[model samples]
Target: METNEVFEKVKGLFVEDLGIDESKVTMDAKLEEDLEIDSLGIVEVVMAFEDEFDIEIDDEELADVSTVGQAVNLLHSKI
Candidate 1:
């Protein structure tokens, strides 16, 4: 899928599923710091992404995915 498509999907997951504010789901927003998603929350997010894209995401692969852009890029690459 395209990067923008992945971004929109991720944003939807954050807003609809994760209960994050829509305005705070920007590309530069930090998933933990900016969005207030803790470790468990990150796990929830990873699971959500995996389910949405029908792909599995390794925890090791997500080591450096700190921001929304990084997550979207990772998912886009996977898709």
Candidate 2:
């Protein structure tokens, strides 16, 4: 999938599942700090991404994914 596609999908997941404002789901938005997603929420988001993309995401891989851009990049790599 394209990077933009991954970004859009991730953004949608954050909006639908986490109830985040769609306007705040920008590439630079911080999942924890900006979006106020707790650790458990992060895990759930990761799982949702995995299911959405049909790809496995290890915990270690998620360690550095703090921003929407980072997550989209990771998803792009996995795809």
Name the candidate that leads on lDDT: 1
Per-residue C-alpha lDDT of model 2 across residues 1-79, encoded as one tens digit per residue: 7899888898889899878999999999998899999888888998899899999999999888889899899999989
Residue-by-residue lDDT tens digits, candidate 1, 1-79: 7888889999999999989999999999998899999999998998998899999999999999999999999988888
Q: What would the TM-scores of all predictions be? A: 0.97, 0.95
Query: lDDT of each prediction vs. the true structure?
Result: 0.93, 0.90
TM-score of 1: 0.97
Off by over 4 Å in 1: none
